[model samples]
Target: MKPLHSKTEKALAAFACICLSAVLSFSALAAEKTYRLTLAETWGPNFPIFGDATKNMAAMAEKMSNGRLKIRIDSSNKHKSPFGVFDMVKSGQYDMGHSASYYWKGKVPNTLFFTTMPFGMVASEQYGWFYHGDGMALMEEVYAPHNLLSFPGGNTGVQMGGWFQKEINSVDDLEGLKMRIPGFAGEVLAELGASPTNIAPGELYTALERRTIDALEWVGPGLDLRMGFHKIAPYYYTGWHEPATELQFLVNKRTWERLPEDLQEILRVAMRTAAYDMYIQNAHASAEAWEEMTAEYPDIQVKQFPDDVINALRSANTKLLANYADNDAQAKKILDSQQAYLNKIRRWTSISEEAYLQGQ
Candidate 1:
């Protein structure tokens, strides 16, 4: 008869083979399903970062899901206006959309907090709050009532204030300044005596060039380059009312739920990665664009708003928050959560980001 040791070795080898078979079987099962999703964007093929992001997101999703999921991106012209994207996603008109949360402030007053706060967190801090703090949950809570799932798409860190037809010498200069501003920031602008009008991206240049609006704030240097604001508007200002302007990817709740588990994970991971790419790209591109703009157009002047102007905007933001809290439960919740998260993270930021910037 065979020894007991020999028999035991055979049994252990058989167990190992069974485990390996189970793993392979599960992998094969996961690889069998396919999901097709749509991602809508405002910028078409020409905008480098936006287009690259959309393409990269699609590629990453497919790769991550092992070809089990594929995303097809449609530009704004393919459907209704880009500004209408949030509503379309909410109404299940599309599976996903890439846009700024602030654009939908009419539908969800609090969503702007996720994109930018008047005098709030910068890009790194915003990302910290989003991934680690309560930012994601707060944003999701605000969008949930509207039948959407929202995630951070990207950020244009600490944007250029905007282009102005004339100098903003003081708070008083803002009075009756017909400008294209959106969301709660527009409310803040209105509080400071400016008349804020909501204008879509496609129409902004003509409006500014025709003197229909006195001022306009788009994303930053890279995006502003595309808009060619430098050509029409001579005065470019800094201390962007909407600092750290974030972009969000909004998806339909029902459509998201229909995705398989692996596909869902793929989408989540791809979006998270895309957010990082966007932040880096925007930051780098803004620097290059600013240098190019100043070099090419010596006639144009770039300036920062007066300290008094910044202070007045801050005060307006405070009042804006109070007004928001009075009428909006979700807005209040988001602000509260954001405030708490900021309080927690500020300690580390003081040492890490703030100190480094100061040293710089």
Candidate 2:
């Protein structure tokens, strides 16, 4: 028989093997664990670029996590509440949400600033404000109290002014005009004596066709083509409101807290990548759709609002924003941050993008 010391060593080696095997088994189980999240989006099923952003985000997150993270998306059709996404996510009825931040302006007044403002920065400039400037911090301040975290979901670079039944010639033409315009822009239009109403996306075409609304601004050519607004409305005005219409992804704070740090990072990177992809996709789709629209419908009149009308709207927008700033401290903070950033970046935009476009 072996010496007692040798036997003791052998016993220790066996015990060590068992401990190592147990540790390896525990790690394997940990690696196999999965986390699932549910998302509610404001758009309808397969709703093109807007809907695609959510899908892209979910796919990226799942793939990046190597099947450890999975996200299920419910469109408006499934959830049956396009505008209620904010409340659902906030209440923890949904783990996440995809919608426009400005949609919640009535419920949360400070949310109005997160989406595009009238005469606001363009997409690139607004994105810079979001990531490189104080935009994200300001947004968090607005959302943190509500048990929600918001991020830029996607963007429609520069939305069209709207589809109009009649041409707007002067400021007077806006008087008593019933339009489906949402967000702070609606408030601006209200100040200008226009009746602005927010309508759900599914009902917009019917509302406009039925004369329930004299005009409506959906997205640009990218989305407008599918809605066939040109078939009914002869005139399409250029954009003024929503210069960079950014959509939002909202997360329930509780749900976010439950995610591991690695998963949280994955979600963030996925959302950001999806948002950028949607912006590029929209731009390309708009270009292609515009060509198709012009070719198929020669009668479609692409018109710009008169200088006096634009100037009047711009003046009204400024005054209304001032009123909001005066009424609410949070609004003031957000507005101040956006304006300061806009003032700084617009100089570069003018010399770079504006000059380049003019030269082209």
Taking the tens digit of each residue's C-alpha lDDT, what string does model 1 give over 1-360?
655477779898889999999999998775686878887887654467766777778899999877888888888768757788887788877899988888877776677788888777888888888889888888887888888999988777887778999998898999999999886778988998899998867789999999999999887888788789999889988765766777888889998888877678889999888878988998888889878988999888889889998888888889879888888787777888778877877789899878999999
Q: Cα deviation of 163 in candidate 1 (Å)?
A: 0.6
Off by over 4 Å in 2: 1-27
lDDT of 1: 0.83
Candidate 2: TM-score?
Answer: 0.94
lDDT of 2 by residue, 51-109 (tens): 99999999999999999999999999998999999999999999999999999988998
**In angstroms, how far off is 291's CA in candidate 1?**
1.7
* RMSD to truth, every model: 5.4, 2.9
Off by over 4 Å in 1: 1-30
TM-score for each of the candidates: 0.88, 0.94
